[model samples]
Target: MLKAILIDDEHDCVELMVRELARNCPQVQVVGRTTSSEEGFRLIQVLQPDLVFLDIEMPRMNGFQLLEKLDTLPFSLIFVTAYNEFAVKAFRFSALDYLLKPIDVVDLQEAVRKAERQHRIDGRQLELLKTQLHSHHLAEKIAVPYQQGIIFLPVNEVIYAESDSNYTKLHATQNRQYLLTRTLREVQEVLEERGFLRVHRQYIINLEHIQKLVKGEGVYLQLSNGVSIPVARQQKDRLLQRFGWL
Candidate 1:
């Protein structure tokens, strides 16, 4: 059984989480819960839980401040927040798992399963997350899970992404390539806002790296890296509009 602790400033939120955990996750044993970040910090030290469900907003200290006060985090962390869309994007870039307020059962179960598999995010990832959140600006680095660990890659360095069956291959600067476990669609969601355009069902190219666009029998995009990518008939109009050529 995974020993767990719940920390939220709202008493109702804590109670609801306790009830939900009891119903959906039988493997998790809630060792302690608190409505104060300071008290929660003490509870964590005393209980020494395997997992912690932490709320991001709290009076006096808040979640991030409380985390900074700690010397080392030995337990897995799952952030519970009611932050805006930009904050949610920040969480994604940092490769951290967050549960939105009024948690969904499916999401909760999935997060717990992941915690069971990988105990916690590495220290570097957590530091990256803190830097982005504290600065109130989305960082240019994106954390991608690699092997059994994670890699923080600069978004600007990525040249293009290609679909490879169930996985997506990221082609970057310096002739480097990474095969991600996520699908092309999943990768597109993260890269599209960062100047990447999905020109074909099989390819996403960085706008900054476009060398030329050949519109002939078959439309193809010439990238700065010297790789030619085909453009889907349906996506050509959108791609053209992106550059105001339409």
Candidate 2:
């Protein structure tokens, strides 16, 4: 059984979560529960649980602050919060699991299963997550599902992304290409804000890698990697808008 702890500010939340864990996730055994962040911190040091269902908001210390206090973390944290838009965005980029309050049992179970699969948590990973959450910076890496495992690549190395039917192919700086099961649309949702522009329905090019733009009846983009992709006739305006040319 996975030893776990719950740390929330609300008494009702603590009660509900305990019930949920008992009813839904039998594999997780609740070793401790506390409504105080300070007490929660102390419990973690004493019990040293394998999993922690952490609440993001507390009276004295928020979730990030609590994490900063723990110098050594051996457990996986599944954050529970109401709506932390900014933090959630960072969490998605960092590939961290979080449950939104009014938490669904399905999502809770999924997080538990994921935690069980990844048995140990690295302290540095927690630090990275804290950095991503606290700073106005892009996530350090992105995870791409490969054959039987996931490949974590630095976000800066991405040169462009190509649509491979249903799968998206990630073209990186080192002449590496990874075919991801995720659709181009899904990849765009993650990469679009990070200086990537969808020049065509089939291609999303990295803005930083544009070598030159040749104007014609239709515009064409030459990438740093020596490949040119056509800008779709309809998306031409949106593409040009990136350079303030339209």
Candidate 3:
């Protein structure tokens, strides 16, 4: 049996999760439950469970705080949250597993099964999940509130992203530039895997569009469309290494 724990501030939420675990996650034997992060931390250290169903928002200490405090993460964390916007992005960026509120039986079961499979894999899944999440979280995507929302921009279409004060400007193919509400850091996280290289703190360029590297004049890059992007002196060597020139 897989040892497990449930941590949530709401008693009803905890109870509901416990019931679902009992019914669907037969492989998991819940050894502890708690509302306080302090208590949860103690239980985790003591129990050393195989799985932990955590809630993002809680009194006194949030789930993230609890995670941050752990000397060593004990088991697979399945974050439960009612609000899906901010927390979801964080979890996705961290490559951590989470379930949205009003938890569906199907999603819950899948999450449990994934946890069990991950446990068997013994760290490989964790690494892969982290990689995938990091990539997914950084991609240029828009989550509009309503009316056929959520637009995902293909990484290939992106020429470069520039920081605009608090926001970021996405320059796509065909000279189309879009003003995004998100910060450049967030955009960097998603595009790093898709050949988006941060040549400078304020600019991230698409590697696929690079046509040629001009050795002199600060190592400027000639794009496929004949646009030249100035490559920072520090970034030249790394870019060469990335292209297997070194």
Candidate 4:
């Protein structure tokens, strides 16, 4: 059984999570629970849990602050919060698991299962998450799951993204490409605010890397890397509007 701890400011929330874990996740044994971040930090050190269900909005010390106090993180972390879109994107970029408020049992079980498989986080991944959250700006780098580990890639290095069935292929600077397990739509949602535009159903191109836009024969864009991406008819106007051409 995976020993787990629950940390949240709301006593009621903690209680509910405990019950849910007990009912749904028999593999996870609740070793400790705390309503205070400070207390939670102590519980983690004392209990030495295998997993931690952390709430972001807590008094005295929020989740990130509590994490900073730790010398090392040896447990799997699954954030539980009512965080906004920016925070969600941060979790995605860090390749971390998060359960949104009004928690879904299905997602909780999935998170637990993932934790059971790989129950520890990379320190750099945590730092990446902290940097993005603390900066309150678009992320500079993204942790992409590659092979058996994760690769931290600069956001600006991404020149374009191609749809590959359920997966997304990322083309970056230095003539490199990576296959991400996430779908094209998921990739778009995270990269759109970071200067990427879905010009076609199969592609999301970085606006900054567009070298030329050919008008003839079903309009297409040539990127700095010399890859020509076709622009969907529906997205043509939006793409043109981005360059003040419409």
Candidate 5:
């Protein structure tokens, strides 16, 4: 059985969720429920449930703030919110799950099933999601998944990435280029914090490896490896902004 916790400011809602979990989701056992974020955080540290049904709004500390305080999140989260337009949009964008207020039994059952399936498929997906969520607080490091095995690369080693159809080519200062099966957009999403900039539609260059910018008749980048990359007209302004020139 999956241990779970229900956190909400409304006592009635918390009771309802607990009852629903008991009735609909036999696989989940409610370890605790609370209206206070502080108490909820404490319980989370103690119980270490398999999942948390978190409410986004609460006095003193909100749900997101509670998640922020955790050094290492102990469980997967299914956000429970009444009405927060922006928060809902963010949840969808981040590919996380949430249930709006006036929760339906069907929705609750579906959410629990999805969470269980995710846990069974790859336990590491939860860890990856947590890492992606709190990556800002982590030290700079890159783990590139490969067919042979995972490659641990320091963020500083990557010089640039170029799109090749559905794959991306990673160029590093070690005189080796790696072909990854990830799209350019996915690569951009993961490497945004490591000073990577898209100078063209097909190219993402590491700002640390840029030797100089040649902006004459047509803009081009002078890389540390003596390779010149043509900068697209539309992306030139954004590239300049990346260097704090704008």
Candidate 6:
């Protein structure tokens, strides 16, 4: 069974989830529950639970504040927030689990299922999430979760990404290529803000890695790694404009 704890200022929210966990989730054992952030911090040190269901909105110290206070995070976090805005923020923080207020039994079970699968939380991952949340700088690296472990690739080292049937192939410097289980569309969506541009349906290029642009009936991009990827005719204009070639 997974040892778990709940930290939320909402009395009813904690009570409802506690009851639901007892009724439906036999795999999880709730070790402690707290309505105060400071008390929860002490409980975490004492219990050292496998998982923590943390509420985002609280007086004095919110969820982010409590997370910042910790020197090291050993447990997986499942963020609970009442609004959709915080949900996006949670995702940006690479939160593995997120539950909205008036949590559904199914969502709660799903969150616990993920928690059970994780053996331990990576401290580097927590640090990266914290940096992304607090800093103005673009995220320097993006970690891709794979079957055995995670692949932490420096964003700048990535030359481009190509579609590989259901998977996306990430090509980086030194001729390294990783076939990720996630789709190219998903990868594009995440890194689109960070200089990744989809120049064709099959390819998204790292603007910083472009060596030369070849023009013909269509266009082709030659990456620093010497891979020439074809650019779709429709995207040519957008690409040129983005590169200030137009």
lDDT of 5 at 84: 53
**lDDT of candidate 2?**
0.81
Model 5 lDDT-worst window of ten: 120-129
lDDT of 4 by residue, 51-113 (tens): 999998887799988998999898989999898889888888888889998899998998898
Task: Give lDDT tens digits, candidate 5, residues 1-246.
Answer: 999988899999999998888888999999999999999999899998889999877999988778778777646678888755444433432435679888988878877876674441222333333454454342344545444433556668888889999788888886868776557886776566567888788999888898987878898898898888888989867875766662
Model 6 agreement with the true structure over 1-246: per-residue lDDT tens digits? 888889999999989989999998999899999999998999889999889999877999988788778888878788787765433442543534578788888879877887776655665665666576556444678765555656677888898999999788888888888776556886777768788899999999999998898887767889898889998888878886887783
- Candidate 3 lDDT by residue in tens digits, 108-197: 987786676555222332343344444544434322111122234555788888899867887878886676545688667766766789
Per-candidate local distance difference test: 0.86, 0.81, 0.71, 0.89, 0.74, 0.79
Question: Candidate 6: lDDT of 169?
Answer: 85
Highest-lDDT candidate: 4
The C-alpha stretches of model 1 lying farther than 4 A from their native spots are 162-169, 179-186, 214-217, 224-227, 244-246
- Candidate 2 global TM-score: 0.72
Off by over 4 Å in 2: 135-154, 161-170, 176-187, 198-204, 211-223, 226-237, 243-246
* Per-model TM-score on C-alpha atoms: 0.86, 0.72, 0.51, 0.86, 0.50, 0.71
Clashing pairs in 6: none
Order of models, best lDDT first: 4, 1, 2, 6, 5, 3
lDDT of 2 by residue, 74-139 (tens): 787898988666666566555567898888999899889878866555554555567766686667
Best of the two (2, 6) by TM-score: 2
Off by over 4 Å in 3: 120-246
Worst 10-residue lDDT window, candidate 1? 113-122
